[model samples]
Target chain A: MSYTTDPARIERNWRAITIELDSPRPGRLERMLQRLGLPTDVSRLVVATPALRRSWFVALGLSMLIGLLATDAAKPRDDLFVLLLIAPLVPTLGVAMAYGSNADPAHEVGLATPMSGLRLVLTRAAAVLGFSAAFLALISLLAPSAPAMAFGWLIPSFGLCSATVAAMTFMAPRRAATVAGTLWVLGVLIARGAGDDPLAAFTVVGQVLMAVVAVVGLVVAVQRRDRFDLLAVR
Target chain B: MTNSEIDAVGQADQEDRALVARIARRDRSALEQLYRRHAHWMTPRLESRCGDPDLVDMAIQDTFVSVWKSAKKYRGDGAVGAWLWGIAIRRLIDQMRKKRPTSVDLQAVGGLEHAMAFEDTLIDNGTHGSLGVALRQLDPDLRAVLIATAIDGLTTKEAARLLGVPQGTVKTRLMRARQHLQETLA
Candidate 1:
């Protein structure tokens, strides 16, 4: 017939969400990673792989030369430069293909695991970046002149290419991403025809523009978080 | 600061950071180090929730798989412990949900509607120390949501995601659960 407002009574009656200050088990995460076929050594080898990393740097060098030729300051080969600028996109395209090939089971299995969506994105990106960086470094070494000669243009070119790739990736469907990427690369060729210095054109101003594209892409991806199926090839 | 205490703190910080970095790189050793660091706490917590040793073990296994795949995404934004908790909670929910028929809509709680009536009776009469007893009386669904959101301190949005419910549903269920708990205690 009586009511009690006692704080201790209320606390005692209310279930505390029991939390244990311990971990799951020894060797569990390692075994899980191993099951996913992503062992440390393999990851390291993937990062250190020459084929995966250098393609981007090679593309960067070639693009810069094409840019220089577009400026028509020295009449270096025009057709050759076009091919060079086009080369880097191949690896990313290959990535799309590889991702598409394993689209089903990988996504299902990955989703079944405890990994968050953000972690998945970061790991995939890091693997790609490591390979690309190594390749760039290698090209710089084999042709000392290339790194030294293109140092000024390298940053802008890389920034633009990366920004474009990142931006285009957010486009719905792989077809669109592919189309956008192709258009952007072709846009460089058009800029060449405008008789402007490609290197000069892709300066800080170009970087800022590319950065804007990248930021927009990031926002779009974040906003569409729920729709990003691991099974979707794009 | 005391020299010995400071050194211990420094060592712990280094070890934690190293473990996280290695996990990001998909290093099994790093993953093992992380598991050793957290398993003692996580296992018992999961075991308490499921009350089934085998289910708890499976949940733990699933949690680590998630961690390995997503390690690169850590970003060091939150405490590693908290991140681990987040993963474990989600994995546990997934396991629970999977037990239902494939035809069952994950968003719908229709199958467990009967459990709510039983859960309502779990209200205790303001006995402060009897909280665990009251919790044990709760339906599994209500118990899980309360433990995850109220006790674990996960945001409602996160709880909704883990439970595979819409945000509105999580709020409704959480409010109802709290009211039951308050009345039971009072």
Candidate 2:
């Protein structure tokens, strides 16, 4: 037990300690993304989406409060009305906060790679949409019309989210999302008021219109996707 | 420092500084040299604070890993051993934190209480010389506070944070520690 053992006698059993040499084990979401065939770096970037950010929790908590309160206090049909209205806003909020120099913390580093901008936006938007859809579907089950009603918001949510990403190529995410989200709410309200049915926006005719919006918005997003590669695409 | 720089001990410190610099560039061999040099001494020091060999083992692993990652942060002016010990102690504290969801009480035998036990080990190893014997006669609480300030070179605020006591409490205990040590040594 001599403290001053010669260097020749010192046991360098460091092979036992190289476990930390590898990068930190990927988180659950990041691992899942990797399994889905995303590269390690891209998967990591995707998992850092708003769902894990502190502000994302604020957005989610607001949506949860709306879903739970609307279920308890509002009438059954009116509950669906409130649920439909709030569901689309979650992904819209997430997509708004997903990319752009203003929304992203890595904007300076991101500017170094000119081509990754749209790929970053699309991958991050997909993660946001998946998370928002999963969360909203669970909340919708609490509605009086449990199963069939659960799928209703998916199309509208997809439409609004895509439209926000489209708008984001030209403006900042927050402003783009605000404009997209506001338009969806106003469009739904106008439809509800114009018809005999309070849930006019949830009808099949309205669903087809949303499908059109999804197609057109994604087309515009792809065509002008290059705009996202520029500086301050706000 | 210039006058002391000629000493044999200072030359060893200078060698350790070069090893740390090499480690910053991800040199595996330099890290091994550092581990061989310090791990033999640091293990018993850590085990004296945390008896669990597994916790000590993990803490040692974490310490060298940190030294590898944070080598660039080394100021070069301080002894590399001191820098490694700082990371080791904090890492031990962190490992202890994982085993207990509640805050770690430093005074507990498995936690900072073991830190107090090191004073005994210091005497057993005769590393602290005559000061260790004199300090043994002082109250454990005063001795613990004194060790945090004197040996660890922590400021009042930092000692309070490390010991999980209020700043005012650390201040009071430090004053009492000085008074008690003077009475004991006198």
Candidate 3:
């Protein structure tokens, strides 16, 4: 009937009541991932094609076609600049379309999986960026500009795509794409208006600035990536 | 309450925080380590509440999966064990809501008897006698909030969300529960 406030005694009783049940068997989580059709191995998860489907590839091809057409239409002096501006949209939009609750149909399932939200977003972003960069590089050979000008869009594309993915962490995918796309277009227009050189935005200074922004944006994205897995706001 | 006890608690907290950080970085081994560390205690506690082994297992699985996804949101302000308990209890509640009436046969499973036995064991122990009796005397509604906020270490808001009640309601019940315990134990 008497009460005791002895901290050690209380701790002992608490520990007594907390019976340690059996730990789950190894590969139990892996089986769950297999049921969900996700990669069982965390290392293989990055290269898994679940995030990028046929629709994304179609979108990529269409975007590349549009870029090539735009480049062919523009004058020879503006060809490389036009390609630089047009090429990044493929990856920026691809990044948006490949992830996010609004973009990926399997988003809820992905969120519920063992893969961290940051890892999911980063993996998809990397795939989209890598695919688009390589595709653009191959297509740039057909552009009538110098080889340096041909690869001019690479840094800016990476920066813009990274920025878009970071933005998607806080907002819906399409909205993030719009905001990133608008900023990119406006930057190109302002640079064109300011100078006679069409490739001013892809200059050494511009490329360096873009690279810095890419790194910062990636850091920010990784920091806030948990927002992606949040239940949709009612 | 001893210095060594405090140090032990602090070390556990640091380890829990580090585990969560690793989980946020997609370290599966860290997740497994955390699961092994806490799942043993969490499983039995959740099973004691829900009284269904299947439901307890599902809740535990879902809790760790959620931890993997949202470990970045853990601010490290409180005990990590409490945070894990909060998630586990809420996941149990969610499963109960989804599978109520038909799936969880409380009477068939002797749920009330189990809970009573749990209470009696705590009250019989001299260390928990007063607190246990006070808790057993409160209405189930009030007791649930008290157990969630006080025993499980969930925030009032988190407790309210888990109980599907307003934050104000949880606070009021908590205050009333405390007053009743004070009066009875006095």
Candidate 2 TM-score, C-alpha based: 0.51
Lowest summed lDDT window (length 10), candidate 3 chain A: A1-10
Q: Is candidate 1 or candidate 2 better by DockQ?
A: 2
lDDT of 3 by residue, B52-100 (tens): 6666667777787788779999988888998998899888877866664
Runs off by more than 4 Å, candidate 3 = A1-51, A55-63, A66-74, B1-186
The ten-residue window of minimal lDDT in model 2 chain A covers: A4-13
Name the regions of candidate 1 deviating beyond 4 angstroms: A1-84, A87-91, A94-105, A140-173, A198-201, A230-234, B1-186
Best by lDDT: 2
User: Per DockQ, what order, best first?
Assistant: 2, 1, 3
DockQ of each: 0.02, 0.15, 0.02
Model 3, residue A176: what's the lDDT? 89
Q: How many clashes in candidate 3?
A: 0
Q: Give residue A41's lDDT in candidate 2 (0 to 100).
A: 81
Q: Write the per-residue lDDT of candidate 2 for residues B12-111, one digit (tens) a residue.
A: 8889999998999999889989998898778766665555556767788888888888899998767899988888877776776566323445546343
Q: What is the lDDT for A175 in model 1?
A: 55
Q: Could you give me the TM-score of model 1 versus the true structure? A: 0.35
